[model samples]
Target chain A: MSKIIEIKKLRKVYGDGVELVALDDVDLTIEEGEVLSIVGPSGSGKSTLLNMIGLLDTPSNGEIWLKGQNISKASSKERARLRNKELGFIFQYHHLLPEFSAVENVMMPLLIAGVEKKEARHRAITLLEEVGLGDQLNNKPNQLSGGQNQRVAVARALAGHPSIVIGDEPTGNLDSKSSDMIYELLRKLNREMNQTFILVTHDMDMAEKTDRILRLVDGKIVCEMLRDGDKFVTRDLCKLDK
Target chain B: MLELFVAMKHIRTRKRQTVLAVGAVGLAVAIIIVFRSLMNGSFETFFDIFFELAPHVLVLPKEGEEYIYLYKTLIEFIWAIPGVAAVSPALSTTATLSFEDNVENVDMTGVVPAELNKVTSIGDKYMIEGDLYAIQSGRRVALGDKMIEKLEVQMGEDVVASFPDANTMNLVVAGVFRTGVEEWDQAAFVSLETAQEFLGDGDVITYINIQIEDPYQADEVAAEISALGYDAESWRTMFPQFEESLAFETFSNNLILVLVLLIASFGIANVMNMLVLEKTREVGMLMAMGTNQSQIRRIFLIESGILGLAGGIFGTAFGYLVSAYFNSLQYTVNAPTAPQPIVIKFLVDPFDLIAFSLLALILSMIAGVYPAHKASKLDPVVALRG
Candidate 1:
């Protein structure tokens, strides 16, 4: 498969006085239709790396080639356009607009992209149904349960049919059953639609279900594991560095 | 379009705050309307009453000269100028009137009765009894009712009139009238020929009274007349204090208008700021969904602008209703300078109401700018964390 994203030496520094390094010389690549996860302990920079690839934050230094465009230093406006057209994001919390109903929340990305309201609503209905929320179309975020809200958020993320979806602990706040349901739903979308997904999670069980996993520590990827049928092959980048 | 939709929802959901804001603007507009209505009503009533009988411009004898010789030519010259509706050349002199056991001092004016009728409302509006035209007959005069009272004389009676160093004349009082003005009610009117005879002066008049189509144009007409070497004065020049007071009132009105609008705009700003603070996470989510900074700003700006427009409309309607209610009262006040009590009416110009509403809308939009900018400049990462 052709590479959909390529990152070369990404670095993000935080604070003017303390200068904490959030992401340090991180390099990675993902192929089209790949389902991958980044897992680590607290303060491991998994969210920061997701934000960089999601175009929500600028890196201190990096060359990011997304679908053949070098967007590392892209202007904020251009980045925002790319975010709308090429990427989708699911946070740990639902992050659905409290003012909008389920269908309306799902229709937001399409609306932001200037889609016609009628067509956007139609597409949002199909996506919500795909996420098993067909009957909750008119319910607001407060009216839905935690898992249902996150499913609605997933429907919103997939509304624009973006090339890549990024999830920062997409099921972190859910119970085990709800988390498994969400993971299966995301996997089903990835396999059925051939869409790429990159998730950040603390749950090893969820991360192990992905096709590949990158383990991070102290702002660096220290290990990687690749799924092989029912097993996984591990690689230790820390030892390879020496 | 999305910004507008979101803005409408935001305002709709905050019903209490919106009502308070709209009520503030409404009260301000209502206060201004009531104040302006009463103020303009007073000025209008004063103009209607005073200009009813007074000349717009009066041409008196030139300095160092007692009378205008060949006044007929001057009268014709004044009538040809644009806006000059009527002109009456008259001679006025102090005279002593004696009628059997009563004697009184009277100011007597000589005129062509028809011309005097055209210049002032005395003949139609103020006359209480008898016809002014009766003075057209020789040796006949119209005496004020008050003067008639002082002389203990009635119409068809004879009164002896004498001026200092001039011949005494016995005139038949053919008419009696009252004008409600103390000075005019103590006066008498006779034919020009009789006045010339009584003064023993040949073909000369002391002053000319002019009525113009527009009283406000009096100054220009007076200027034109003064250029001909006569002493001319417009009513405005004769009453500088009135203009000064009106100017002061206008200044205070503008000041109050600005202050009231400023106070109302502050309310708008406060509501918008609170909205921005409360919607921080929502703003971040919008940004993450690829809504640009400018679009974020537009949402908040449109929200406040909607509030402003709503407030403006509310205020305009409220102001109109209050002014109309005040007008229905039909109050009256005594005017010490005027002959009778004046009725007060509230008058509002439709155009003024529209302009004030638009001004409120514009100011409210301005008030939205700061908060909208602050919302736009928010860091998406930090905001999303909240």
Candidate 2:
């Protein structure tokens, strides 16, 4: 119902002598409590867009507003603070610290935000149980299966109770069954907690499960699809010329 | 606190690397401690032998004067100085002693037995045969034990002594002493009256020996006495070579310690760098979780500091054990110039040990800085992509 994030004229260019444009003049908006996905080919800048929203990378040119605050040019420390307090991220590889157990991995963001250890641990356990990882609390990432590790990563992302959760191909490394399970879990969490989620993926089936889908090609959104009664219907052709 | 927890976990999980790094640092510290203790022990033993054999300060006659004519007043004046423990005036000359079959050159000194006993340890510590006080009553001599062997004479035997342009005298050997030091053992002592008669000088002495409460305060005490227009010298000034050698030994020992510690610190740096490289992805995840660059740097520093502390403790314990073992053995060492061998007991000062441990910690921290900085500066996106 309300705009949670807005990006205008976003651009990311890499290299010194010969520049390669990763994202070009991208304009997008995310609504609160919405489950949405960005679907595109492999080199279409979907992950780059996810990284920008997650505050994991600096943009060369952009105006990004998160809950009415402009954070496009925030200092690195401030960016980290915003990322910890307002955003949660799940990467394709799970990216859990190998030295920590599942519960500890879930508790990291809470601890980083200066939460007490006991409280963080309790909340992390609750989140892990919610993600059906109750029995794997003390298991390290290497000791767990691909699906179970992704579940642990999901629990970790939700541990901070962030306003927005961002996933960059979170299920890309898992099998189809594990991928569907992850999608179901994300859908359930979005409904129960009323938290917004933005996923980047190439799986058309996974994209169809979200409330809305944005199709990207050559760093530009060409169309958007809205879910209507168990199916997605294209709203309009919003293609940008090169 | 979380940073520390993470650091500790990192160290714990890498068992082999941690042990190797810690072992390198520990071995370096142990080597430093052992060598430092041995050098300190040897110096202590050397100074003990030197101070016992010589006076803290000696007052000689003015230039061109053969003897101190006003020796009595000079002795009284030296005795009045603060920290002066005892003062004795003595006359000494090189003379030859001849028995029936053997003859040898000896340094002859004359002293008042009571005063000499107070200024030197000869009467109390070195006497092996008849009493030095026996010389006070008659024209008797206390000869060194080695001289007794060389001259083929026994205690209570009469020997003929002669000096340049002085009448030869017949003296009976009354006491035998052994100091374990060649220079002191080959000397002889007699009554002051006998020396005055033999040297044909009336109530005069060659030098006044002054013992002090602290041997290290010799320079200050000697300076005060020298200000009174006498040729005064401390034992340190008299033996410049010994001082130089002691200084050189300390310098070389410390140089070795620095080099070893530097090498050990490089090993720490190398290990830490490898850890940083290996944990690049985890570092990116931490950054994504809101850990600042400074916090990232602190995590690595704390890890290295813990390693250094662990190593220092282990090394100090190992060094103490080894030193104690050697000290218990009471190994004998031969000083090149001395005729006797000394029993060496390793002594490690507690303050020196603490300082060396702290030095190890500081050096390891310095070595960790580069790697920590590199870890902190990593790009989260690129690192995560790895």
Number of the predicted model whose lDDT against the real structure is largest? 2
Q: After superposition, how far is residue A174 of candidate 1 from its true place, in Å?
A: 3.0
lDDT of 1 by residue, B158-211 (tens): 999986787898999988877677788889999988898889978899999998
- Model 1 quality (TM-score): 0.86
Off by over 4 Å in 1: A132-136, A236-242, B49-54, B59-94, B101-105, B110-157, B164-182, B190-215, B219-233, B336-338
Docking class of 1: medium
The residue ranges of model 2 lying beyond 4 angstroms of the native Cα positions read: A238-242, B60-107, B112-139, B145-153, B159-171, B177-186, B191-214, B223-231, B334-337
For candidate 2, lDDT tens digit of each residue in B1-386? 78997999999999998998899999999888888888889898877777776788889988889888887777777778788888888989777999997989999998988778877777887899999889987689999998999999998789999988766899999999988777778899999888888888688899988888877788988898788788999988998898899899899889989899889988889999999999999999999888889999999998888888788888887887888888899899786765467888789888867887888888899999999999999999988987
Candidate RMSDs in order = 3.8, 3.8
Q: List the residue pairs that clash in candidate 2.
A: none
* TM-score against truth, every candidate: 0.86, 0.87
Worst 10 residues of 1 chain B by lDDT: B334-343
Docking class of 2: medium
Worst 10 residues of 2 chain A by lDDT: A233-242
